[model samples]
Target: MRDAGESPLLVAADTFRAAAIEQLETWASRLDIPIVSGRPDGDPAAVVFDAINAANARGNSTVIADTAGRLHTKGHLMDELGKIVRVTGRAREGAPDEVLLVLDGTAGQNAIQQARQFTKDANVTGLVITKLDGTAKGGAVFAIVHELGLPVKYLGVGEKADDLVPMDARAFVDALLPRAA
Candidate 1:
Protein backbone atom coordinates (compact mmCIF):
# COMPACT_ATOMS: atom_id res chain seq x y z
CA MET A 1 0.00 0.00 0.00
CA ARG A 2 1.07 3.60 -0.50
CA ASP A 3 2.29 5.35 2.57
CA ALA A 4 0.52 8.49 3.62
CA GLY A 5 2.48 11.61 2.64
CA GLU A 6 4.62 9.65 0.19
CA SER A 7 4.34 8.49 -3.40
CA PRO A 8 5.88 4.99 -3.04
CA LEU A 9 4.23 1.71 -2.34
CA LEU A 10 5.50 0.71 1.11
CA VAL A 11 4.96 -2.99 0.64
CA ALA A 12 6.22 -6.25 2.04
CA ALA A 13 6.50 -9.35 -0.12
CA ASP A 14 3.30 -10.92 1.08
CA THR A 15 1.37 -7.68 0.77
CA PHE A 16 2.71 -7.15 -2.72
CA ARG A 17 1.75 -10.69 -3.64
CA ALA A 18 -1.79 -10.13 -2.40
CA ALA A 19 -2.17 -6.96 -4.40
CA ALA A 20 -0.83 -8.56 -7.58
CA ILE A 21 -3.20 -11.46 -7.12
CA GLU A 22 -6.15 -9.12 -6.70
CA GLN A 23 -5.24 -7.09 -9.75
CA LEU A 24 -4.91 -10.23 -11.84
CA GLU A 25 -8.26 -11.57 -10.62
CA THR A 26 -9.98 -8.26 -11.38
CA TRP A 27 -8.66 -8.33 -14.93
CA ALA A 28 -10.81 -11.33 -15.89
CA SER A 29 -13.77 -9.01 -15.39
CA ARG A 30 -12.09 -5.66 -16.18
CA LEU A 31 -9.21 -5.98 -18.65
CA ASP A 32 -6.41 -7.33 -16.49
CA ILE A 33 -3.00 -8.92 -16.98
CA PRO A 34 -2.64 -12.64 -16.30
CA ILE A 35 -1.62 -13.35 -12.70
CA VAL A 36 -0.83 -16.32 -10.48
CA SER A 37 0.59 -16.85 -7.02
CA GLY A 38 1.57 -19.60 -4.55
CA ARG A 39 2.80 -18.89 -1.04
CA PRO A 40 6.41 -20.10 -0.56
CA ASP A 41 6.32 -20.52 3.21
CA GLY A 42 9.31 -18.25 3.92
CA ASP A 43 11.72 -20.96 2.98
CA PRO A 44 14.39 -19.79 0.57
CA ALA A 45 14.99 -23.23 -0.88
CA ALA A 46 11.31 -23.90 -1.21
CA VAL A 47 10.68 -20.57 -2.90
CA VAL A 48 13.39 -21.30 -5.44
CA PHE A 49 12.05 -24.77 -6.09
CA ASP A 50 8.48 -23.59 -6.51
CA ALA A 51 9.50 -20.81 -8.85
CA ILE A 52 11.23 -23.27 -11.14
CA ASN A 53 8.29 -25.63 -11.01
CA ALA A 54 5.86 -22.83 -11.72
CA ALA A 55 7.80 -21.89 -14.79
CA ASN A 56 7.60 -25.48 -16.00
CA ALA A 57 3.87 -25.57 -15.42
CA ARG A 58 3.27 -22.50 -17.56
CA GLY A 59 6.12 -22.75 -20.11
CA ASN A 60 7.22 -19.22 -19.12
CA SER A 61 7.54 -17.57 -15.73
CA THR A 62 8.50 -14.25 -14.28
CA VAL A 63 9.99 -14.74 -10.85
CA ILE A 64 10.34 -12.07 -8.22
CA ALA A 65 12.80 -13.48 -5.72
CA ASP A 66 12.79 -11.60 -2.43
CA THR A 67 13.83 -12.18 1.14
CA ALA A 68 12.71 -11.15 4.58
CA GLY A 69 14.35 -7.76 5.08
CA ARG A 70 15.21 -8.94 8.56
CA LEU A 71 16.57 -12.46 8.04
CA HIS A 72 18.20 -12.37 4.60
CA THR A 73 20.57 -9.48 5.40
CA LYS A 74 22.03 -7.49 2.56
CA GLY A 75 24.87 -9.84 1.65
CA HIS A 76 22.82 -12.97 2.05
CA LEU A 77 20.01 -11.65 -0.07
CA MET A 78 22.48 -10.81 -2.80
CA ASP A 79 24.01 -14.28 -2.65
CA GLU A 80 20.70 -16.06 -2.61
CA LEU A 81 19.43 -13.85 -5.41
CA GLY A 82 22.24 -15.10 -7.59
CA LYS A 83 21.26 -18.65 -6.79
CA ILE A 84 17.67 -17.91 -7.74
CA VAL A 85 18.83 -16.60 -11.08
CA ARG A 86 21.02 -19.60 -11.72
CA VAL A 87 18.30 -22.06 -10.84
CA THR A 88 15.81 -20.43 -13.14
CA GLY A 89 18.35 -20.21 -15.95
CA ARG A 90 19.05 -23.93 -15.84
CA ALA A 91 15.41 -24.96 -16.13
CA ARG A 92 14.20 -27.11 -19.04
CA GLU A 93 12.51 -25.65 -22.11
CA GLY A 94 9.16 -25.46 -20.37
CA ALA A 95 10.41 -23.28 -17.49
CA PRO A 96 11.05 -19.55 -17.37
CA ASP A 97 14.42 -18.10 -18.24
CA GLU A 98 13.68 -14.60 -16.97
CA VAL A 99 13.46 -13.37 -13.39
CA LEU A 100 13.06 -9.86 -12.07
CA LEU A 101 13.84 -8.96 -8.49
CA VAL A 102 12.55 -5.73 -7.01
CA LEU A 103 14.52 -3.83 -4.42
CA ASP A 104 13.68 -1.07 -1.95
CA GLY A 105 15.58 1.82 -3.44
CA THR A 106 15.12 4.14 -0.49
CA ALA A 107 16.26 1.69 2.16
CA GLY A 108 19.76 3.10 2.52
CA GLN A 109 23.05 1.20 2.21
CA ASN A 110 21.66 -2.26 2.75
CA ALA A 111 19.14 -2.17 -0.05
CA ILE A 112 21.56 -0.49 -2.40
CA GLN A 113 24.26 -2.94 -1.49
CA GLN A 114 21.98 -5.87 -2.08
CA ALA A 115 21.00 -4.54 -5.48
CA ARG A 116 24.58 -3.80 -6.38
CA GLN A 117 25.79 -7.26 -5.43
CA PHE A 118 22.90 -9.00 -7.11
CA THR A 119 23.55 -7.32 -10.44
CA LYS A 120 27.33 -7.46 -10.31
CA ASP A 121 27.48 -10.96 -11.80
CA ALA A 122 23.82 -11.69 -12.54
CA ASN A 123 21.70 -10.39 -15.38
CA VAL A 124 19.31 -7.78 -14.05
CA THR A 125 17.43 -6.13 -16.89
CA GLY A 126 16.46 -2.92 -15.08
CA LEU A 127 15.88 -1.02 -11.86
CA VAL A 128 12.64 0.49 -10.54
CA ILE A 129 13.27 3.00 -7.80
CA THR A 130 10.33 3.99 -5.66
CA LYS A 131 9.41 7.29 -3.96
CA LEU A 132 11.16 9.21 -6.70
CA ASP A 133 9.28 12.43 -5.93
CA GLY A 134 9.93 12.16 -2.22
CA THR A 135 13.56 11.14 -1.81
CA ALA A 136 15.88 13.74 -0.36
CA LYS A 137 18.69 12.17 -2.38
CA GLY A 138 16.75 11.97 -5.60
CA GLY A 139 19.86 13.19 -7.39
CA ALA A 140 21.42 9.82 -6.63
CA VAL A 141 19.98 8.89 -9.98
CA PHE A 142 23.41 9.68 -11.30
CA ALA A 143 25.03 7.11 -9.08
CA ILE A 144 22.45 4.46 -9.92
CA VAL A 145 22.50 4.99 -13.66
CA HIS A 146 26.21 5.69 -14.10
CA GLU A 147 27.92 3.62 -11.47
CA LEU A 148 25.55 0.72 -10.93
CA GLY A 149 25.53 -0.31 -14.58
CA LEU A 150 21.75 -0.58 -14.56
CA PRO A 151 19.02 1.19 -16.45
CA VAL A 152 16.50 3.11 -14.37
CA LYS A 153 13.28 1.84 -15.88
CA TYR A 154 10.39 2.73 -13.59
CA LEU A 155 10.22 5.74 -11.31
CA GLY A 156 7.41 5.80 -8.78
CA VAL A 157 6.44 9.41 -9.29
CA GLY A 158 3.08 9.07 -7.57
CA GLU A 159 0.73 6.60 -5.88
CA LYS A 160 -1.23 5.65 -8.98
CA ALA A 161 -0.02 3.29 -11.70
CA ASP A 162 -0.45 5.94 -14.38
CA ASP A 163 1.96 8.15 -12.46
CA LEU A 164 4.81 6.00 -13.78
CA VAL A 165 6.61 7.39 -16.78
CA PRO A 166 9.50 5.70 -18.53
CA MET A 167 12.66 7.71 -18.06
CA ASP A 168 13.72 9.10 -21.42
CA ALA A 169 17.40 9.94 -21.46
CA ARG A 170 17.22 13.35 -23.11
CA ALA A 171 13.99 14.45 -21.47
CA PHE A 172 15.16 13.39 -18.04
CA VAL A 173 18.46 15.16 -18.51
CA ASP A 174 16.72 18.33 -19.63
CA ALA A 175 14.30 18.16 -16.72
CA LEU A 176 17.11 17.61 -14.24
CA LEU A 177 19.09 20.57 -15.45
CA PRO A 178 18.18 24.25 -15.42
CA ARG A 179 17.10 25.51 -18.82
CA ALA A 180 17.05 28.92 -20.45
CA ALA A 181 13.70 28.36 -22.14
Candidate 2:
Protein backbone atom coordinates (compact mmCIF):
# COMPACT_ATOMS: atom_id res chain seq x y z
CA MET A 1 0.00 0.00 0.00
CA ARG A 2 2.86 2.42 0.72
CA ASP A 3 4.28 1.72 -2.71
CA ALA A 4 1.20 3.30 -4.32
CA GLY A 5 1.98 6.69 -2.71
CA GLU A 6 -1.56 6.80 -1.37
CA SER A 7 -2.32 7.56 2.24
CA PRO A 8 -3.59 4.25 3.60
CA LEU A 9 -5.68 3.66 6.69
CA LEU A 10 -4.88 0.41 8.48
CA VAL A 11 -8.08 -1.16 9.75
CA ALA A 12 -7.49 -3.56 12.61
CA ALA A 13 -10.28 -6.00 11.85
CA ASP A 14 -8.54 -8.94 13.57
CA THR A 15 -10.73 -8.75 16.63
CA PHE A 16 -10.01 -12.33 17.58
CA ARG A 17 -6.43 -11.56 18.49
CA ALA A 18 -5.45 -8.57 20.54
CA ALA A 19 -1.88 -9.10 19.45
CA ALA A 20 -2.93 -8.78 15.83
CA ILE A 21 -4.43 -5.38 16.47
CA GLU A 22 -1.37 -4.36 18.47
CA GLN A 23 0.89 -5.55 15.71
CA LEU A 24 -1.07 -3.59 13.10
CA GLU A 25 -1.07 -0.54 15.35
CA THR A 26 2.70 -0.81 15.70
CA TRP A 27 3.13 -1.04 11.96
CA ALA A 28 0.75 1.89 11.44
CA SER A 29 2.72 4.00 13.86
CA ARG A 30 6.02 3.00 12.33
CA LEU A 31 4.77 3.73 8.84
CA ASP A 32 3.11 6.94 10.00
CA ILE A 33 -0.28 5.78 8.75
CA PRO A 34 -3.64 6.23 10.40
CA ILE A 35 -5.49 3.23 11.92
CA VAL A 36 -9.12 2.43 12.73
CA SER A 37 -9.92 -0.27 15.26
CA GLY A 38 -13.03 -1.37 17.11
CA ARG A 39 -13.35 -2.38 20.73
CA PRO A 40 -11.47 -5.44 21.89
CA ASP A 41 -12.98 -8.67 20.54
CA GLY A 42 -15.68 -6.75 18.68
CA ASP A 43 -17.11 -7.96 15.43
CA PRO A 44 -14.58 -7.73 12.61
CA ALA A 45 -17.23 -6.66 10.12
CA ALA A 46 -18.16 -3.76 12.36
CA VAL A 47 -14.56 -2.68 12.48
CA VAL A 48 -14.37 -2.87 8.69
CA PHE A 49 -17.49 -0.74 8.39
CA ASP A 50 -16.09 1.82 10.79
CA ALA A 51 -12.77 1.82 9.00
CA ILE A 52 -14.43 2.42 5.64
CA ASN A 53 -16.32 5.35 7.08
CA ALA A 54 -13.15 6.69 8.61
CA ALA A 55 -11.27 6.38 5.36
CA ASN A 56 -14.00 8.22 3.46
CA ALA A 57 -14.19 10.93 6.10
CA ARG A 58 -10.41 11.25 6.32
CA GLY A 59 -10.00 11.23 2.54
CA ASN A 60 -7.72 8.23 2.60
CA SER A 61 -7.38 6.70 -0.83
CA THR A 62 -6.84 3.20 0.55
CA VAL A 63 -7.89 1.14 3.53
CA ILE A 64 -5.93 -2.01 4.33
CA ALA A 65 -7.96 -4.23 6.61
CA ASP A 66 -5.93 -6.67 8.70
CA THR A 67 -8.43 -9.43 9.19
CA ALA A 68 -8.23 -12.28 11.63
CA GLY A 69 -6.34 -15.34 10.52
CA ARG A 70 -8.13 -18.68 10.76
CA LEU A 71 -7.48 -22.21 9.73
CA HIS A 72 -8.99 -23.15 6.39
CA THR A 73 -10.73 -26.00 8.14
CA LYS A 74 -12.73 -23.58 10.26
CA GLY A 75 -15.96 -23.12 8.33
CA HIS A 76 -17.42 -20.59 10.74
CA LEU A 77 -14.34 -18.39 10.64
CA MET A 78 -14.25 -18.55 6.87
CA ASP A 79 -17.88 -17.48 6.80
CA GLU A 80 -16.91 -14.45 8.87
CA LEU A 81 -14.34 -13.52 6.26
CA GLY A 82 -17.04 -13.68 3.58
CA LYS A 83 -19.10 -11.40 5.75
CA ILE A 84 -16.28 -8.91 5.88
CA VAL A 85 -16.00 -8.91 2.09
CA ARG A 86 -19.72 -8.35 1.70
CA VAL A 87 -19.68 -5.54 4.26
CA THR A 88 -16.78 -3.89 2.50
CA GLY A 89 -18.56 -3.91 -0.87
CA ARG A 90 -21.74 -2.59 0.68
CA ALA A 91 -19.81 0.18 2.40
CA ARG A 92 -18.26 1.21 -0.90
CA GLU A 93 -18.73 -0.35 -4.28
CA GLY A 94 -15.60 -2.15 -5.48
CA ALA A 95 -14.08 -1.33 -2.14
CA PRO A 96 -11.63 -4.18 -1.71
CA ASP A 97 -10.12 -3.79 -5.13
CA GLU A 98 -7.69 -6.51 -4.13
CA VAL A 99 -8.29 -9.37 -1.73
CA LEU A 100 -4.81 -10.68 -1.00
CA LEU A 101 -4.27 -13.98 0.80
CA VAL A 102 -1.07 -13.79 2.79
CA LEU A 103 0.70 -17.12 2.88
CA ASP A 104 3.78 -18.21 4.76
CA GLY A 105 6.47 -19.10 2.30
CA THR A 106 7.74 -21.72 4.72
CA ALA A 107 4.38 -23.45 4.68
CA GLY A 108 5.28 -25.31 1.47
CA GLN A 109 2.48 -27.60 0.25
CA ASN A 110 0.30 -26.54 3.16
CA ALA A 111 0.16 -23.07 1.67
CA ILE A 112 -1.41 -24.42 -1.48
CA GLN A 113 -4.25 -25.97 0.50
CA GLN A 114 -4.75 -22.74 2.41
CA ALA A 115 -4.90 -20.72 -0.82
CA ARG A 116 -7.48 -23.09 -2.28
CA GLN A 117 -9.72 -22.66 0.73
CA PHE A 118 -9.20 -18.90 1.01
CA THR A 119 -9.81 -18.36 -2.69
CA LYS A 120 -13.10 -20.16 -2.39
CA ASP A 121 -14.21 -18.66 0.91
CA ALA A 122 -12.81 -15.11 0.86
CA ASN A 123 -12.72 -14.55 -2.90
CA VAL A 124 -8.97 -14.12 -2.85
CA THR A 125 -7.80 -12.15 -5.87
CA GLY A 126 -4.05 -12.54 -5.34
CA LEU A 127 -1.38 -13.72 -2.93
CA VAL A 128 1.18 -12.21 -0.61
CA ILE A 129 3.91 -14.73 0.21
CA THR A 130 5.60 -13.81 3.44
CA LYS A 131 8.88 -14.98 5.08
CA LEU A 132 10.52 -15.38 1.69
CA ASP A 133 13.88 -14.15 2.92
CA GLY A 134 14.30 -17.28 5.01
CA THR A 135 15.38 -20.81 4.11
CA ALA A 136 11.94 -21.33 2.59
CA LYS A 137 12.38 -21.49 -1.19
CA GLY A 138 8.73 -20.48 -1.63
CA GLY A 139 8.35 -23.28 -4.17
CA ALA A 140 4.73 -23.57 -3.09
CA VAL A 141 4.21 -20.34 -5.02
CA PHE A 142 4.26 -22.33 -8.23
CA ALA A 143 1.76 -24.84 -6.90
CA ILE A 144 -0.57 -22.05 -5.80
CA VAL A 145 -0.50 -20.25 -9.16
CA HIS A 146 -0.76 -23.46 -11.12
CA GLU A 147 -3.64 -24.87 -9.13
CA LEU A 148 -5.54 -21.73 -8.17
CA GLY A 149 -4.54 -19.58 -11.18
CA LEU A 150 -4.14 -16.55 -8.96
CA PRO A 151 -1.27 -14.12 -9.32
CA VAL A 152 1.30 -13.50 -6.67
CA LYS A 153 0.99 -9.83 -5.94
CA TYR A 154 3.57 -9.17 -3.26
CA LEU A 155 6.40 -10.78 -1.31
CA GLY A 156 7.27 -10.14 2.30
CA VAL A 157 11.01 -10.58 2.36
CA GLY A 158 11.71 -9.36 5.84
CA GLU A 159 10.29 -7.66 8.88
CA LYS A 160 10.49 -4.12 7.58
CA ALA A 161 7.57 -2.67 5.67
CA ASP A 162 9.92 -1.79 2.83
CA ASP A 163 10.80 -5.47 2.58
CA LEU A 164 7.43 -6.06 0.94
CA VAL A 165 8.36 -6.23 -2.72
CA PRO A 166 6.31 -6.65 -5.88
CA MET A 167 6.29 -10.13 -7.39
CA ASP A 168 8.98 -10.47 -10.04
CA ALA A 169 8.71 -13.88 -11.64
CA ARG A 170 12.23 -14.00 -13.03
CA ALA A 171 13.82 -12.76 -9.86
CA PHE A 172 11.78 -15.10 -7.74
CA VAL A 173 12.64 -18.10 -9.88
CA ASP A 174 16.33 -17.20 -9.94
CA ALA A 175 16.34 -16.77 -6.18
CA LEU A 176 14.51 -20.02 -5.72
CA LEU A 177 16.96 -21.94 -7.89
CA PRO A 178 20.39 -20.37 -7.91
CA ARG A 179 23.15 -21.60 -10.22
CA ALA A 180 25.85 -23.87 -8.75
CA ALA A 181 28.91 -21.98 -7.59
Judged by TM-score, which candidate is best? 2
**Candidate 2 accuracy as lDDT:** 0.90
Q: Which runs in model 2 stand beyond 4 Å of their true positions? A: 1-3
Would you list the C-alpha lDDT of every candidate in the order shown?
Answer: 0.50, 0.90
Off by over 4 Å in 1: 1-31, 48-73, 92-114, 135-137
* Worst ten in a row by lDDT for model 1: 6-15
Tens digits of lDDT, candidate 2, 3-83: 667888999899888588888889889889999977678999999998998899999999899988899999999999999
Q: What's the alpha carbon RMSD for model 2?
A: 1.3
* TM-score, model 1 to reference: 0.58
Candidate 2 local lDDT, residue 88:
93
- For every candidate in turn, the CA RMSD to the true structure comes to 7.9, 1.3
